[model samples]
Target: MKKIKLYRPIENFNKNCSYEILVNGKKMTDLKNGEEKVIGISNELGKLNLRAKIQWCGSEKLLISESNNIEVIKVTGNKFLNRQMPFAGGLFPLTGIVIFSGNSELFKNIGIGILILLLLGLIGTLTIWKSRWLKVIRE
Candidate 1:
């Protein structure tokens, strides 16, 4: 059998908590923050399903090459879209309303419409977040 060396470089965002490593749905080892370990596996010529998850958040998965090709596996924090987008969206319409505040009644009506649209945008943002549309970049 051969051994595979997987290097997990820790970052500040992920260094606070230990990561649970899983191989093919089986718990393998617990990796401490900033710790590098050489993970050994069967030398069989097949793909390996590797997963790593922090304590509080979701898991990130990777597919190891069937052959001995990769030498280093860098693990980093999972990036998510900013949660402040909803607030920003809501504020944008309010800003427009403030700018359009005038003596004309029609202007006030239009502002109300914009406010409704802002609420819709906020709802959409919440939906997007709940659906896990955020993309994870693997280093």
Candidate 2:
């Protein structure tokens, strides 16, 4: 038997949640932030496929070959379109609430708009671009 390590590092956006690790399209384990899980592989197993899924979002299917024999896989929540814009933008409305306490109405309206946009992004990720939500790479 051989061991494959699955590691999930603490990330800024999605660190609070745990993800389901899939081995050959089956739920193998739940990985949490900064946690590592050792998966056992049979010697007779020819090819191994690993993926991470949380709700409808997931990583690209990864195939492990006997030639490379990778033992460690790093997993994390991928940024939207690999950009940091949404993360920074998401904080602006929250900042406004504290900054403009006298004008709560204005900030409330702005927050609603931002929330809607964020919801749309979540919907897109859950449906159209589900595979891009998680990043899984061999280490």
Candidate 3:
């Protein structure tokens, strides 16, 4: 038998929320804030699946590994960039467009075009963020 420990520290996001633990897509237990649990697994060597979900918000985080013994599974909510970058990137270009509109005619068009391109890039980043097509790299 293999044993693994799963722990979640009390954080602002998940401090008061109940976390549902799943291993290999099976319900393990409900963990409260600052709780830890040890789970046993079979000796088979395959992909080990781990997931955690906040009960109230239904937000989830997942981690998969080839090793059987995992020390901790931190449940992180949506990242700041994932939530705010869309608005920031989208709005920043408008300011430039307004500021440069009164400049020389040729320069004004160039500025507006550049700002439009930035808006397009913002839209593309937002699309990727919403669909979750890009994988988040955790340090």
Provide backbone clash counts, one per model: 0, 0, 0
Q: Tens digits of per-residue lDDT for model 2 on 1-139? A: 6678899887777767788998788888999888988887775766778899887778998987665354888998876554573565566567556456676677667767876767776677568987988988988
Top lDDT prediction, candidate number: 2
Prediction RMSDs, each to the true structure: 5.8, 6.1, 6.2
State candidate 3's TM-score.
Answer: 0.46
| TM, every model | 0.51, 0.65, 0.46
Q: Which candidate comes out best when scored by TM-score?
A: 2
Model 2, stretches more than 4 Å misplaced? 67-70, 81-124
User: Ranking under TM-score, best-scoring first?
Assistant: 2, 1, 3
Query: What is the Cα-based lDDT of residue 87 in candidate 3?
Result: 68
Model 3: worst 10 consecutive residues (lDDT sum): 130-139
**Model 1: clashing residue pairs?**
none
Over 1-139, each residue of candidate 3 has an lDDT whose tens digit, in order, gives 6666666665454356666766666777877767777777665846656566453233323455555555555444455544555467666666576647675787667667777777787776545444232121222
Please identify which of the two predictions, 2 or 3, would achieve the higher lDDT against the true structure: 2
